[model samples]
Target chain A: MRRFLKLVAIEWKLTNREFITIFFTLIFPILMLLLFGTMYGNEASEFMGGYGSVDVSTPGYINMIIAVTGIMSLPLTLAQYRERKILKRFMATPTKPIEILLSQFIVNILLTILGLVLLIVVGKIVFDLHFFGNFFEAIFTFFIILLSIFSIGLLIAGVSKNAKMATAIAYIVYFPMLFLSGATMPLQMMPQSIVNISKALPMTYGVTLFKGIWLGDHLIDYPLEIIILFSITLVFGGLAVKFFKWE
Target chain B: MNVIEVKNLIKKYKNFTAVDHISLEVEEGCIFGMLGPNGAGKTTTIECIIGLKNRDGGEVNVLGIDPNVDYKKLYNLIGVQLQETSYQDKIKVYEICELFTSMYENPVDYHILLDRFGLHDKAKSYLSQLSGGQRQKIAIILALISNPKLVFLDELTTGLDPKSRREMWDYIKELKNEGRTVFMTTHYMEEAAYLCDKICIINDGKIIALDTVDGVIDLADIDQVISFETEEDIVQLIEKEIKGINKIEKENKKLKIYSKREDLLTDLVIFLKEKSIKYRKIDINRPGLEDAFIKLTEKTRKVE
Candidate 1:
């Protein structure tokens, strides 16, 4: 346990030393939130109309967009670590693979929370938007969404041989989730075929669970969403752990 | 007792044997050297012994523990310095030392190690900023921090200049004084001659010679060469009349006589005087480790 901690500490220190990585990982997501939030303010109405029949003013759609954006940022952070060989060096030590993966999980979770806070803060201070329901429920749902998305990111990083390939794979996996999860376009407006396909995506379940709390509507019960999200987390997380290549 | 024992160790990569049926033993508290040229399977053997590579056949025991089954226990007892010591560019020397030391239960003091390597002032410097020799010193320090019972050093002084090479030799001697067993592989014959109590010369993934330094040198039956600049064709006379002379060659006004008897030198002097053939200069050269290495490897090649 002590050895694992030492490895984690060393990895953390090395990660911090890369000034550019810190800027992109921790600060760049906040920058993106501010830039995108400002550009789409009130204009989210026009963009919603092109998707066909959904109302732009729905609070659920707005909240899903904010939450899915935060989840997509997880992959960029992990790909940076893989590019630098920090994972390979740690594996050569006495540190177990599980501990190394856990440390990355903890770091990604903290960053996701930071990104969430930035989006919320920007949403309230700039756009005068407010979340609809119990604060604790919203926070707990957000946690599950972030965890599930990050596990997918972990799987991508573990399987990729290099950063360039990882970036390409992350984008290929992320764009469909963002576009189809009722984040940018309401699921009610999308064709039934697309909805049926998106239902298999973990992000779709996340967006549904998140939207439930955002609009205070019991569209899907919280317990069922939690169970589905947890299952997705376990399966992807196990595959990531099983196939992870330290080098 | 032997600290390391291997029997018929074999490693094959898709029908190509990298390490073939090699066997050797390293006694406790001795500087054992694995002398070989490049692509001689030295690194493969070391990796297999350390459990970094799997062996197709044979048994390996380090400190009475099987590395394949008990690597965790073996890891705690042995330290290794590979040819390349990789690290993050921004990590400072002291941080690396501390981090590697923390992996073991009982570790030597980091500061003291830095001082001993004359790297105390560079403790705060990053790895990218250090010289090659300094980086190598840091690697050695990291290897010894655990104060392991057995240490493996691969090409430990390959690129160092002469002065730094001598310093590293002294450091290895210090480790010997502290009762540590070191298994090292090197291409430098002089380094082996200076430090190794026992050496196994490996060629083509097999042990060609294994013995004390002097014993290996003595195994070659060829005698030394005595060369001199002479005005006469003394090579012809020496080849015909010298009783113990094995071979004689002459080129560019110089004569070389190879003899098995030591008294051949005295006889040659008397023979030259009788012929009134005064030589400009003469020198007698004895066979050294390099000569034995060439002879053994050449003989092995011929037998194959």
Candidate 2:
């Protein structure tokens, strides 16, 4: 346990020194939330009309965007660490690789929560938005969405060789999650073929669960969505552990 | 007893053999030097000994523990300083020493180690801000922080200036005085000759020569070198005049006459005076380690 804590402390120190971590992990996300949140404002609902047949002001669109952004955080951070050889150095230490991975996961979770808090603060102060519909359910769904997204990111970072390639591949996975998961547009209004494909994506269930919670829909009806999120987390997390390359 | 032992160890990267089936032993409390050229499998052998790489064949025992099976225990007892000093550029020297020291059960005093390396004043400075020699000093200090019974140093003074190189050598000797065994690899022949109690000279992943410094030098065969400056064709003259002159070569405007005869120098000086040859200078000296290394390796290559 002491070894694990020491490794975590080292990781923290390295993260603090990395300019990219300070920029993308902290500053970039906050700037993005503030900039995008205000630009869309009340028109966030109107922006949702472009994707599908669902009504724009159904409260589902806001929840979808938040979930998708939360998912994006995981890959961006993990890939950066892998590309910089931070994971490789950590592995060279006496600490177990699993401990290092756990520390990174915890740090990423905290960073995502901080970003979420900032987004909410800006949303409430400037855009007059509220996320207070069944706060416990909302928080539960948010945690699930964060875990699912983080798992995918871990998988990508572990498998990829370089940062640029990881970033490219992550975006290839990211754009579809945003566009087809009903984050940027409503999936219900889209063509049947597109909806079917998007439903298979991990982020799709997270967006659906978030919308269901926000709109006070029946949680029992979204069992498949919950199951899909949990399943994706397990599969991706397992693959990450098995195939992760430190160097 | 041997602190570390390897028998016919081999490591292959695909088709190319990095560490051939070579065997050697490191006695406790002795400074063992693995002397070789750049690609002579020194680092590969060191890595294999430290359990950082798996061997394809043969056996290795470090401190009575097989590295492959008992890596955790081996790591606890052994300290390794790789050729390269890699760390977070923003980390201070003190932090690096402290962090690495925490991994061991009994660590040396961090400040004292830093002071020994002359890095006490630069403790708070970031790694990027320090000079290459200073950074290397810090790396060495980090390696010693654990106070391991056996320490591995790979090319410990490769890129340092002359003064820094000598300083590092003194520090290594100090470690030896503290009764710690050091297994180091170096390309510098003088370093091995001066510091190593026993040296294993490796080439092309094979042990060409293994012995004490004086033992190797004694085996070189060639004894006296009679060097004299001359512009004329002295080779033909020496072949005709000097009876016991076995070999002759001209290097840098001086003719070198090699022989085992002790009185060859006196005879040559008399001959030069009697002949009235206006030579610039004359020198007579015995063979050194460099001569031995060249002669042994050169003969080995010819047989191959």
Candidate 3:
């Protein structure tokens, strides 16, 4: 237990040392909230379909945090550790390798929650954002989206041959979803062809489902989104476990 | 008592036999060196004994424990530094020490270890700021921090400077003085001769020789080469007339005499004097661990 605590602390420190993770998770989402909130004035705007600009993108920004930790930081760190044989070195110790893995999950998941809370706080303070859905329902749906995206990151980490390849693949998957899934941009303003493209992306469903719940719609009304997110979680999570490599 | 015992151990990577039915035993409180060429399966055998790799056949016992089945407990007693392993680049030197020491059952104070390695002042420096030699030194220090009853080091001084290498040799000797069994593999012959009480040489996934430094040299049976600069071409004369000579090699006026006979040098002078062949700059080269290692790993069949 002492060993695990030390590993978690070390992993946490190491994660903090990464500038990109910090920017994407903590700084960039706030930038987005402030950027969009200033332009649209946080009023019930027709541009966002009766939701305030900050109100809508605020939840979407939580998905953005999920993308940063789940798709970018988590997979990249695992790949770098494996490529460098850091995992093998730790394995030779009395510490179980699983503890190292579990600590990463714990740290990334906690960071996602922290980022989500920060976004919500900024939205509430700066824009007086309205929350109409049940608070518990919002928390529950946030986790489902978090898991599905994180599992994709795990799958990416498992299949990549090296850290460099992992980065390239992660960029390919993440950048498109970042811009197209309405995580960063309002999908209502996109060309009809781009909106059609978002239909095929998994994050679009996540954002669409999460936005609906954030706008006072119940989770049961979005069965397709719930089923799709759970399917992604089950399939990608299983494949990640099957193909995971320690070295 | 034997700290490590292996019987007919075998490990294969796909169809290629990596560790082919090899066996050796390491007694307590001695530095046992494994010497072999690249791709000779030395690392594979170490991995199997350390429980990092599974054996295809045969049994391995480390400190009376089956490594493959009970490694978590066994690891508390043994320290290992794998060759290709590395530290996290963003982690500080002190943090790495703390993290590694936390995993052991009874770890020594790593601060003292860092001071011993001359890394005390670099505690705050990230791994990216340190040199390769410094990181390698940390690996060695981390291995000892476990206060292990047994230590396994693969290529312990491959990237170290001369000072650090000598320091490591002295420290490893100190480990043996403390009654810790040390098992290591290195390509440096002098390092092995200076550090190892017993040595094992494997080639082609099989044990070729396991003996002491001089014993391995003797086992390879390499003849000493006696060289002399001769004014005349007496190669045929030395070959035909000299007694106790195994073979003769000549390049121009330089003649090299290879023989296992102890009296070949004396007999060669007498023969050359009888023939009145003027010779100067005569020298005899005795074979050491390197010649034996090369011959044993490259040319010999399995001898164990």
Model 2: pairs clashing at backbone N, Cα or C within 3 Å: A52-A189, A52-A190, A53-A189
Q: Over the stretch B1-304, how does candidate 3's per-residue lDDT look in tens digits?
A: 9999999999988889999899899999999999898899988899999998889999999998999999999988898989978888689988998888888888999999888878999999998888777888788888888889999999988878888788788888988998999999998899999999999998888888999999999999999999989779777767778777788888888888899987888888888788788889999999999999888776755443
A132 Cα displacement, candidate 2 (Å): 4.6
Interface RMSD of 2: 3.3
Ranking by lDDT: 3, 1, 2
Tens digit per residue, CA lDDT, model 2, B241-304: 8888888988877888888888887778888888877787788888877777778777767877
Instruction: Decide which is better by DockQ, 1 or 3.
Output: 3
**Angstrom error at residue A93, model 3:** 1.3
lDDT of 2: 0.73
- What's the C-alpha lDDT at position B178 in model 1? 89
lDDT of 1 by residue, A109-225 (tens): 554455456555655666665555677877777777766777777788778877777778877876787678766556877999999988977777777777667656553467777
DockQ comparisons of all candidates to the true complex: 0.30, 0.30, 0.83
Over A1-247, each residue of candidate 3 has an lDDT whose tens digit, in order, gives 7878888888998988889898899889998888878887788877678877777887778888999899999899989988998888888877887787788888899888888888878888998988878788898899999999999999998889899999999999899999999988879889999999998888998999888898899999999999999999999999999999887
Error of 1 at A13 (Å): 1.4
Error of 2 at A162 (Å): 4.7
- Give the lDDT of residue A167 in candidate 1: 72
